[model samples]
Each structure stands twice: as structure tokens, then as C-alpha cells.
Target: MSSINTNKKNTITWLLLLLFTVISVYIGEVLELFTTQKSLFIGAVLFIVFLKGQQIIDVFMELKYAPKLWRRLLLGYVILLPIIIGIIYLV
Candidate 1:
């Protein structure tokens, strides 16, 4: 019974995450279409997107329950990825 409930909860969480992601994408696209100049709304939208990304990464990667070594490795990759991309772009 507990396992069944757990499954249901996880399913709901996933569905909510999907819905939020879709809504965020649509909002960002609409904002882009109507706005020519940057605004505060742009910042808000970016923050929401980043928050959603963190949620997805935490859930999908199971980082919340992972070992210390695994968590550190994941963090290292996350930290290095942006730097690597920036260097590549610069080159």
C-alpha cells in the first residue's frame, strides 16, 4: 500500500514538472515575441527556468540520495560544463 502511494506521488510530481516546463517554455517564447528591449520580466523568466532545471536535475539524477563522492562528481561536472562551453565559444 505504501509503495503504491509512493508510485502515485512520484507520477504526480513528474506530471507537474512536465506541465511547469511546458508553461515556462511557452511564456518565454511569448515574451520574446512581444518584447524588443530587455525588462525585469526577462529576469523573472530566466529565474523560473533555472529553478525548474535544478528541480529536474535533482529528481532525475537522484542527487538528493546519492553518495558524497557521486554528488561531488556531479557538482564538478556542473561547474565545469559552463566554463568548457564558454571557452569553446570564445575559441
Candidate 2:
């Protein structure tokens, strides 16, 4: 029964990730529609990137059951890298 529950959870996680991926692609298409002021579009995409990364780390990596320190480090990297890149992009 535990195994079955785990499988169901994994399936749900996968489906949610797939939905997010589709949304990301749609956002990318919409971004192309903007001829000027791309910063907002870029920011939106970066946010989606962050969300996807967070989901991957938490669900696929099973970081939710990991040590607090390790989870923090991995999740921090997932968040910080994007912010750094965004800052670089804006400068």
C-alpha cells in the first residue's frame, strides 16, 4: 500500500511538472510577441524557470526528505543562480 501511494505521488508530480513545462513553452511564444520592453517577459520566464527547478529539486531529487542543510544548499542554488543571471542580463 505504501508503494502504491508512492507511485501515485510520483505520477502526480510528473503530471504537474508536465503542465508547468507546457505553460513555460506557451509563455515563451507569448514573449516573442513583445517587440519592445522584453525585461518583463524575461523576468516571467525566469520565474517559471525557478518554479520548475524548485519542483525538480523537491520531487525528483527527493530533497523534501533530505537533511535540512542539504535541502537548503540545493534549493538555494536553484534560486540564486537565476537571480544572478537576471541581474547580469539587466546590467
Best candidate (score: lDDT) = 2
Highest TM-score among the candidates is held by which one? 2
lDDT of 2 by residue, 30-88 (tens): 77686566677678878888888888888779888889999899889988998998888
Q: Write the per-residue lDDT of candidate 1 for residues 1-59, one digit (tens) a residue.
A: 38788577568768877887787788778877887644534554555555555555566
Task: Tell me the lDDT of candidate 2.
Answer: 0.84
**Clash pairs, model 1 backbone:** none
How do all models score by TM-score? 0.53, 0.87
Please give the clash total of every predicted structure, in order: 0, 0
